[model samples]
Target: MGTREEIAFDRALGALIGGALGDAMGMPTQLLSPAEIKADYGFVDCFIDPAPEHPVSKGLKAGAVTDDTEQTLLMASVLLQSGDSFDHHAWVNALVAWEKDIKARGGYDLLGPSTKRAIDAINAGTPPEEAGRSGETNGAAMRIAPVGILVPPGEALIARVAESCRATHNTTLAISSAAAVASVISHGIDGADWREAIGFAVAAARAGEKQGHWVPGGTIAARIEWALDMVEGCSIEEGIARVFDRLGTAVISQESVPAAFAVLKLAKGDAWEAAVIAANLGGDTDTIGAIAGSMAGACAGYDRLPQDRIGGLVGIDLDDVRELARALVRARLTDEKARHG
Candidate 1:
């Protein structure tokens, strides 16, 4: 076995790559129902080309990622450039530039509803803080694995996630959702199994709900437990179906985030299996797949991922992810040493 630092670095890289792999795997089936997905590609266990009629991902080759991976890379880039200091203005600027770049490249980018509105408002000179107050979607949660890589789990993780999410998902549910995903990834990087990580994820969700603008919905923390509890004894197929039908798979933070965790539970922390389940899961497939993938990959480590998909991902840099993961761990270690001293 590797040393603790070596393990953290590998798990951090695994989280990023697994997110991209699942994003690509689910891209074609993103908005389609399970019936629709089955009609088109059957199981969706591997990378396949998006259909010509695909709403968001047509004209791209197999293994091409969608907005989920793009925004994740965007968050990673900003975090790396700024180090421990976060600049809201700079982050907004990056979002604007990303959209502009997308438009320039033929306008096929699938920005989520909350993110699109926040970006438009920010471009029109609204303060980023106020612009996202009403936002409540999984957009924040879908791309927050980078924050997990940067911080260890605890109050610091929750606070950092709030800052990253405030620009596009400022509502209580949204922040809590992101916190759950990030918390899982953080704990996983520290070598916790899904059994231990889920408890921490629930704690983080509760803490995060206290950060953003208050909104009334089923508590994210409660739904995570509820979603997992309902699917406890069932087989993989039954669990995924229960999550899809009962827990939901919509873009709402409450639905999709819990759905991701449910898939993770059924997949038992296997990155490849989680991706397969999430890819075929129907609504918000790419985001759900990416979220589950990050957590599972981090806990399971790099060796457990699908090598074919790792080599197949398009428009992503594995080498860059490797370097970024190392840097993030180094930064975290420095922070810990300073704090203890």
Candidate 2:
């Protein structure tokens, strides 16, 4: 019987590994329309040779992760080095350093336009908050799960994560989207049920709404409510199909975030099912899989992941990620004990 600490560590490791696996597996087909993906690959279930023209294809075939996992691990390294505290300068410096490394490696040289602009602003001596423009890209939200794990749960942590998002994604929609996903991961670590996690995610979205970071009128909750109504009584396959058909697969936060949530709900608490469904959704498949995988990993714990898939992942620090996850858990527990003691 594993101890509670061992179980929690496993879950966190599962999430990290599962997230990277999903991302790498789906990278080759990312952003391809469903029809296009079908015509080219016929239900892609594993990482394949990238089309010659695909930017990530070369790296995908080599089992190298894209910016998604790279940025995530970068954040994790920063948090572990910082003893789980938020330091704006240190965070910004980390981002800069990672950006430089990615560029040097020619890996993320062709960065998302918004990310490039934000990084350029930072390089030009702009403050983190002022560095970002009003871009609603998923760049920020896609790599934000580490922040959720590092911070304690509450409005304060939520707000801090949202603000940290301003370093690259300052748009209201982008920030709100990041907060929604981050909140779900945080709630999952706290051992909240799926319903409660969804509720907390909605609350975090509302918190962003309150800060004028969401669309005016109804919030992410309203959108999720509408999405749920659309998929009510539908099969997971049907729901995923409908979302992919209607939303299309793009890297925009608004396009992929809700779709990820829809898949999460449809999975009915099965991490593998949720991740596989999200990964094959066509556009921005990697991002969708990453988001849903994070939630599912938190919900199911790492031990539930298939050892086969975990074994298939390459070009990353699996051991370091596991250690980092355990460290983050320790940091959280230490903080909680201090607060309650």
Model 1: how far is 274 from its true place, Å? 0.6
How far does residue 88 in candidate 1 sit from its true spot (Å)? Answer: 1.0
Q: How accurate locally is residue 50 in candidate 1, as Cα lDDT from 0 to 100?
A: 84
lDDT tens digits, residues 1-341, model 2? Answer: 67656765666675676667667766777878777777777876665667777755554453445667777777777766765344556766777777788778766564566777877788799877776655577777677777677665688667767666766777677777778887877777766655677777766765665542343333555565555566667886688788877754577776777777787788776666766676567888877877777777776677777777667666687778887898877877777778889
Writing each residue's lDDT as its tens digit, candidate 1 over 1-341 gives 99878998889888888888878888888889998999999888888998899888787888887778888878887887877677777887888788878888885756788988988888899888877887889999999998998898889999999998888888899999999999999998889987888888888999999988998899999999998897898898788789888989999999999999998888888887888899888999989999999998888788778887789988787787788778887877778889989
Q: Could you say which candidate leads in lDDT?
A: 1
Model 2 C-alpha RMSD to native: 2.5
Q: Point to the candidate with the largest TM-score.
A: 1
**Local distance difference test, each candidate:** 0.87, 0.70
Clashes of 2: 2
Each prediction's number of clashing residue pairs: 0, 2
For candidate 1, list the clashing residue pairs, or say none.
none
Candidate 1 regions exceeding 4 Å error are: none
